[model samples]
Target: MQYQLRVSGNLYKELQQHLFPGDGKEAVAVALCGRYERDGISILLVHELMLIPHKECYRAEDVVCWKTETILPFLEKASKKDMAILKIHSHPGGFPAFSDVDDESDKDLFSSVFGWCESDSVHGSAVMLPEGRIFGRVITPKLESFPFDKVSVAGDEIKVWEHNTSSYSPDDFAVRTAQAFGEGTYSKLRRLKVGVVGCSGTGSPTIEQLKRLGIGELVLIDPDEVEHKNLNRILNTTREDANLRRLKTEVLSSHIRETGLGTKVVAYPFNLYDSPEALQELITCDIIFGCVDSVDGRHLISQLTNFYLIPYFDQGVKLDADGKGGIDKVSGTVHFIQPGSSSLLSRGQYTRQILFDECLRRQDPVEYSKRLKAGYVHNADVDRPAVISINMQISSMAINEFLNRLHSFKNEPARNYAQVSMDYSDGSICNVAEDDLPVDDYQVMWAGRGDLSTFLRMIELSAVKV
Candidate 1:
């Protein structure tokens, strides 16, 4: 089910300045075991694993840990016994070398892995990165890493290989899972084609996380190039990129490649708003992520999500300049749009007035820019989006929404749309949600029929049918 997208076009250097943030690289296996039947749970992708290397003891900042109790929520709804075949997380900090703590952990963790792989013979191996430059391998039993030549991730796909078959170790599973990066977050990701509509701000983080999460194929779109003005945010882009005017999509595609993560990224240096192929290509993806600044973009994407039943996650952020200059307020929203769930447009989250106006102005970037500099009654302008904190907050919220949509969590959580505003005008060490704000057209979707939650419903319905 793994997929790949051949990259095309040259990326302008301006766009390269937006990937990776603050002191961090990756150091763990982003592995996935798929299409297996034993778990009875149709398909599952376990992420953010903490591997016990029998020689290391450590904690993780980026490990995607599943609340062991999270499994309980699924039991009442699904039929499969719990199964864990995949183990992946990065050496977020410290050397990629397994700590003594890792040793204590890997046995039981892999014990789970060993059991999960019962249907298969070879256990999965450990993927470790000693440094940003070298990707090391640690096979179970033998515990030695062969060197991989080059790691590439186009979008969601992850491929790890040494010289050839010689690097394929029978003792570990990373060899095979690494082959496809089988939807690193869900068993279905391998078969799913994803689209990233923008490559700056939230879009950059979205793609960065998607690469780490390991999806098989991705199509990237964005006509904008990196600008020094964007240095305040945008993941993975470097400052130097601004000087060179690199295309956002191309630069992001290269950064994804650097991870040695195997994903196929198809780059299109065009705005989805004007690109006919954009909608056509997105229609084919399992899910679509929207990160463009135009309300028109989100409205258009929402319409598409409603028609095709493709799951979509959209993020919006706003920040008010500080009275004296230090950003005073931040706000963000993360909304999940299920194709058949609800009419995002009908809800009035996006108005025909705004959509039409933006559409009309789409042909003229400069005129539209002037109007945005003038601001609107309820519109977010790309020129002055909510500062980084708000952007980061909603980015995390959106990523979590992706996770929630992927896994079958308990409670059949309702309300897939939420927006929060932050104002530290008073300056207190606390977090609060901004309510009663105008959400006149905030569309709500994902009425539980797009992903694992959808599957969870099926399981429950089937149980009732019995």
Candidate 2:
């Protein structure tokens, strides 16, 4: 089994500050993390750090030795919450591997943490190099250790470090993709698992692009059935499919399988919020594409990205008319939200009232009806203008942004932009830049909050039992 650890940029920075105090001596830090299991792999998500006051520890530039008594309190807290504990320390000497000293100390240390705390939760030890890179392993209750194959950090950008020391060569399909981006990038793309929320206008096109680009696995979620009107925008849909009212996810999934490609596809033919199994399955994806238009769905996706520490790409196209058959507003936007960064709410794409109204409708339809009738809140438009050309343009831009993030072909410096919007009417494009770093305590409620009680307050139906 492969073990991977993901930490938010905010939590990651805190770890650095706590463990790498500028005294050029090693410092010790303790953190509590959530554990998730998928496909025989166990993932640890480091949420927050509980720094130990180490004013009287035996310290050196390469090592720090603390009494086992100092960590018992922290271990007891983790034991009560059933959360895993990580013992993190810094090596300012830029040593990548665990030293002989580490090997001797960890076995005795973690064995004590598990036995003394009386918690079955898995615990591990980590070492941070001078460059802020991390490597760690998971120690079982029986004192067996498994080295992590990868460590990923998600923030304004996505960074990954693989620990496997093996030779890799691209195959023919990947070699062709390497022509544009190097072979290393193509290899990464083949290992990624991408999720698409909506399988309509923007979603269908994005799914087609991802499969053709050779993503390793895809999780497609959509509940709607193909209608005659949907034939205009949805790809891989025939008149027969619309006539038969076939599920949108099934049709697109079938099309991908017919190609005889090696891409793995899992389709969920139900609303994600109503399908707890599908929502939980999203934890396996590396990145997600939000093609949904519902305010409730977008809000869920936003929270899911942060909870799972995955990157999110959200795209939307809109066309408004002046009621005289003339276009008044022709615009679209593509937003890339990194975990623990600015969200759609913080970026002003959505308002608190919208989210509140959506929640009310989902939780209490009777109250929502009364409020709507009293003119307190308005419903979103049911039928909006959609064109295939505009949808394709927006989807293409989103795909290119994903590629740029992976390969960084753009020459400009990287900044965290809340959104990139294009107004076709005025032939203008603008980028709304968000600050470089998140506020110290921003979204603390959701950061590394692996699994919540009701799946971000959607209700009992949204809870993930699996």
User: Residues 1-466, candidate 2, lDDT per residue (tens digit)?
Assistant: 7787888876787888877788888888877786666567677888778776668578898888887677676677677756678888888888888888988888888877787657565677888877888898888898888887778777555566667744346666566778897877777777788999999989999999898888878999999999998799999899999989999999999998987667889999988777877877787778899999888889888887877788889998989977897879999999888766678777767787988887788778999999999989878636887889889889998988888777778666345455778899999987765574333234556677575455554465555753
For each candidate, give its TM-score against the true structure: 0.49, 0.89
Estimate every model's Cα lDDT from 0 to 1: 0.48, 0.80
| Residue pairs clashing, model 2 | none
Best by the TM-score measure: 2
- lDDT for 69 (candidate 2): 79
lDDT of 2 at 217: 87
Poorest lDDT segment (10 consecutive residues) of candidate 2 = 436-445
lDDT of 2 at 431: 75
* Model 1 C-alpha lDDT per residue in residues 71-103, reported as the tens digit of each score: 232222222432223333345454554556555
